[model samples]
Target: MTTPRPVDCWLTDMDGVLVHEETAIPGAAEFIAALRESGRRFLVMTNNSIYTPRDLSARLAASGIDVPEDAIWTSAMATAQFLDDQRPGGSAYVVGEAGLTTALYEVGYTMSERDPDYVVLGETRTYSFEAITKAIRLIEGGARFIATNPDVSGPSQQGTLPATGSVAALITAATGRKPYYVGKPNPLMMRSALNRIDAHSETTVMVGDRMDTDVVSGLEAGLRTILVLTGSTSRARVENFPYRPTRVVESVADIVPLVTEFAPVTGPEY
Candidate 1:
């Protein structure tokens, strides 16, 4: 067998892997620092389309974790990239906040409500029936449907709130058109992340707390994966899946040392 390359680039999930709401997970800050100090290319990624990278960076800072704007990636950014690739300088009828809108604008996309190239959906706390109606109408009018992510719900101080996927379902039920999702579990998102960083799958590692989205997508994208128990998944839950991550750890604290020096995890099964 050809020898595997060392872990050089890292793509990590942000919400469960780093911080939980306003609190930073133990050693997550150190893990970020270690990657930075090691000069490794890394991105703190999230599926939430509500906040821009700058906004997310500030939020992380509030939790005592320091990550720069450029080192962050979001579903909104990925959606914009996908749209830009598929139809450069296109038009869209968006139902999202500044993050999604700014990304589209930065990519030279014109926002239109009439005969748009696409009807883009994203996460927002203020979604209303009127907004859903508009999106459904646009889709029925020949606008291709697109969504930032497939997360059905998002966490808040109060509890879980309906997310982009839930709204997408509502629109689908009305129009019978399924949207192209541009975030995690799409493997396209992982490949896009790799392209954004100029990372080779052989030399990159994906660290996440979700078996369904993170580990699965990373695996399908031909990258090594590490499942941490700091978020949505636990040890008992790992066996529920048919596949396995290259490694499983309690948290990011276990990975701080691997940032600078890691033996490539390259088993035949992995």
Candidate 2:
């Protein structure tokens, strides 16, 4: 078995690991504050593409966790970056909220609902049949399909709502083409976040609640992964899973102490 390595930087998931449905988790704010005080560089990496970095930062601040705009990295940003790199100046027909639309626009990707070069899907609160129909039409008309993430649903204030993956699935069934996913569990998203901090895999650790997406993505990226049990994943799932995280804690609050003790000591002890 591979042993865990010390992390110079940390990448954290926002929803489950930090908070649940706009309510901050116990000790979460303090954990982030401690990290900030220690001068540790950490980025909030989220698969949710519904909010731009500024929007997300504001939301976090509202919840008592003061996060800067640039400290937050969303799949929307990753998707925009990917599109810019792959098909620069290509037109995109987007079926998502203001956040997704804003990111693409900021990146200079042309937006159109007809005869577009690409059809990008993200989580939209107002997902209507008309929206799906328009996306399907564009995709069938030969536009490349791109999805922000594979999350089928997400927890909201009311309950779980359909996520972008579900819409992408509908489009896939209609067009017979799989959309390219640009979120967690995808190495590109991880690489994008790491690039922001100029951090390497060996020196970075990814902390999240989901093993399938968060832990798996970090492991695939050669980064140490820490699974916090405050969200979707349960203790039972962790024990039975074939791929285990480098460390498993009850919540993000436990990370600093865990890492402090678990990280390798450099000098030889007397």
Candidate 3:
């Protein structure tokens, strides 16, 4: 067997690996601190497209995980980046919240309903039927479809909430146009996040909780992946999937020491 590549950069999912439904996961703060102190390139990734990075930072801070805005990479930002690269300064009919809108605007995208170039779907607490209807019409009128992520539902303070994938399905059923998703499970999101940090896949490691979204995406992106059993995925469910993460840990707490003691192994060290 070949020796494992030494990890010099890190990409981690925010929801399960760091915070769990408004609460900070065990050792999340320590892991973040270790990353910052290690001088290694690191980014906190999230499929949730509802909040901007700044908003997310504040929310994480409230949970005692003091990650900065620049350190957080959301699906909204990835979607914007993909659109910008595909067609810079293009227009879209968006059906989401401020997070998605702000990212698009920053990337030189215009919001319009009059024959827009694309109909972008994102996550929001309250999805409006009128907005979705307008999106369907625009899509039928020759607009391409795009979405932030494929998560059909997300955890909320009260309970489960319908997310971007669910709404995108509604639009697809109405217009017969499926959206190209730009978030987790779509390796594009992982590549985009890596690009943002100027990190290479060979030296990067992705830490996540969910087997479907986190591990699969990282594996497809050619990054070593770690699956932590502190969120949506359970230890028993991991074996059901054909693909496996590079490493599986009990929780984020188990990963803290790894980061803190990370050292590049060279020559006969293996």
Candidate 4:
């Protein structure tokens, strides 16, 4: 019920906030367009590592929401950036799909099947026992472990499908090594996104559907959090959570009114 202060930037979650599975959420496109016209910076931040920013943008446009390639951030990009800074020149044993592999490769990291310096896990629909076994061996052999995101499952047309967390868990169980998470709910990802906007934590708003990741991460980062009920999170779930968002709305459509209420407009200048 508390009002959120005006923020300079909005970091959004894609899967449930903007679109549900393959369909775009109602009024999502128009809301984004309005925000754009108002000069309020916004970006799509997703834990899904199966697609690159460009791919995500294309998918969004196809789903009826027009977003630029640079306006999207994926766990894959964050993971690659982390690796680039933390483990430069180190070989990675990848068990992810094209997006993850592409990001790692773009960052000058070599992907290998054997004797890797790190084991990177992400969502891969083409997962195989061979891939899992190789990753386990590498981790057991003292390779550093990292997962793109900790999402247990992703929304799919058929329902929720297994995500990178499931694979990361299996690898951890087999190798007894915990992977460093590099996605939402993790401060590292928020920090990276904030850096991109050249904005401070206090001036940023993390808006999304999930409380465990998006809202918690924003709160931890000292950013305002907004919970939209267009995704996996329910109103009852938010009530049960220890922390609360700055504002709770039915969907992104409610954001405009909330923004106007929190920060009233004045007469326009020529």
Candidate 5:
């Protein structure tokens, strides 16, 4: 067993660890407040590329979490950073919301439908057949493929909704090219967040609800991982995975005291 380090920074998932479907989870507010009050560097990460950071911030605020826009990091931002690093001033034919497109634009990427460098796929409420068709044609025309995340379905009050991975699969079936998914479980997304905060993986803790994505990615990135059972995975299911988190708790509420006890105070508490 790898010994856990004291937490100096944090990377938490938005959906399960902090909130669930527009509702803030119990104790989530206290945990975030602790982080902010302690002046510990942290970022609320999400794989959903449907909304920009500002949009997410506003949504979280409405849900009772007072996270600022800059404190949130999305897969869209990661994808844009990846693309910008790979090819500065590149062009892409994007099929996503303002979240993905805006990030790309900020990074100096141009939206093009004519044989662009890449065909980027992301989350959208309506996956237009016309856009998917365009993406397929572009990929067949020799453009590379990229997607924000591999989540096939997302939770909703009504039911499961087809997500980015499902749409990416459809494109793959036609083009025979798998996209480079840049979200959770990729490790790149974790690395990107760490870089954003200038935090080292050795001193950072990752809190998430899924073993396949959050725990694995954090472990690979050399961060202590915490699995919260407030969302998708259950207690019994934790053992099913070959890997395990540093600790497993019932929810974010349960971890607040642990964080307080373990977190080193960098500044005087208010």
Candidate 6:
């Protein structure tokens, strides 16, 4: 077997690995502190395209996670980066919150309903039927479709709420155009995050909670993956997936010591 490089960079999911809802998981703050003290390049990543990095930073701070705005990577930002590379100075008919719009604007993208280059869909609190209808019409008129993530639903105090993927499906049913998702489960999200931190996948580790989204994406992106049990997928259920993460721990707390214990993972690669 080839000798693996030392893990010098880290990419982690925000919601499950660090904070669960409004509370910070145990050792999450220390985990960040350890990464910072170790001088490791890292990013706190999320698929929620509703809030910008600054907004997310404040939220994480409130939850006691203290991640910087620039250190956070969101689906909105990845989507913007993707569109900017695909078609610079493009136009879009967006159906998301300020996060998506702001990212697009920062990338020199214009928003319009009149024959826009793309119909970009993202996460929002209140998805407007009127807005979705307009997006469908624009798509039918030859606009490409793009979405932030593939999560069909999100969590809330009230209960499960329909998210971007659900709405994107609605538009697909109407316009026969499936959107290209830019968030978790798509290796592009990992690649974009890697590029944002100027980190190489060979020497980076991706820590997340879900087997499907986090593990699979990191595996495909050529990074070692660590699965935590404090989220959606349980250890017992991990074997259900055809692919696997490099390591599995009870939570981020268990990963604190590994900040300085970098080594190549010898797990079989998919």
User: What lDDT is reached at residue 168 by model 5?
Assistant: 96
Task: In angstroms, give how far residue 5 of model 4 lies from its true place.
Answer: 5.0
lDDT, model 2: 0.84
In candidate 4, what are the lDDT values of residues 1-270, reduced to their tens digit?
344345678788887888976789987887778667777777889888888888888889999898898788888999999999987977898888888999999989998876888888988778899989988888888889999999887766677688888888888888888999999889889999888778787667788899999989988898878888988789878778888887788888877664544452121110
Q: What residue pairs are clashing in model 1?
A: none
Candidates in order have lDDT scores of 0.91, 0.84, 0.89, 0.83, 0.91, 0.92
lDDT of 2 by residue, 157-261 (tens): 788798888888888998899999999889889999999889888888888999999999998998878888999899788867788887777888877674444
Give one digit per residue, the lDDT tens place, for model 6 in 16-121. Answer: 8999888999999999988988899999999999999999999989988888898999999999999999999999999999999999999999999888999999
Q: Which stretches of candidate 2 lie over 4 Å from their true place?
A: 1-5, 258-270
Give candidate 4's whole-model lDDT.
0.83
In model 6, the runs with Cα more than 4 Å from the true position are 263-270
What are the RMSDs of all candidates, in order?
Answer: 1.6, 3.5, 2.7, 4.5, 4.0, 1.7
TM-score of each: 0.96, 0.93, 0.96, 0.92, 0.95, 0.97
TM-score of candidate 1 to 2 decimals: 0.96
Candidate 5's TM-score reads 0.95
Q: lDDT tens string, model 1, 69-173?
A: 999889999999999999999999999998999999999999998899999999888998887898899899899999999999888899989999999998999
On residues 144-220, what C-alpha lDDT tens digit does candidate 3 reach at each position?
Answer: 99999999998878888988889888888888889999999999999999998999998898989999999899989
What TM-score quantifies how close candidate 4 is to the native fold?
0.92
Would you list the clashing residue pairs of candidate 6? none
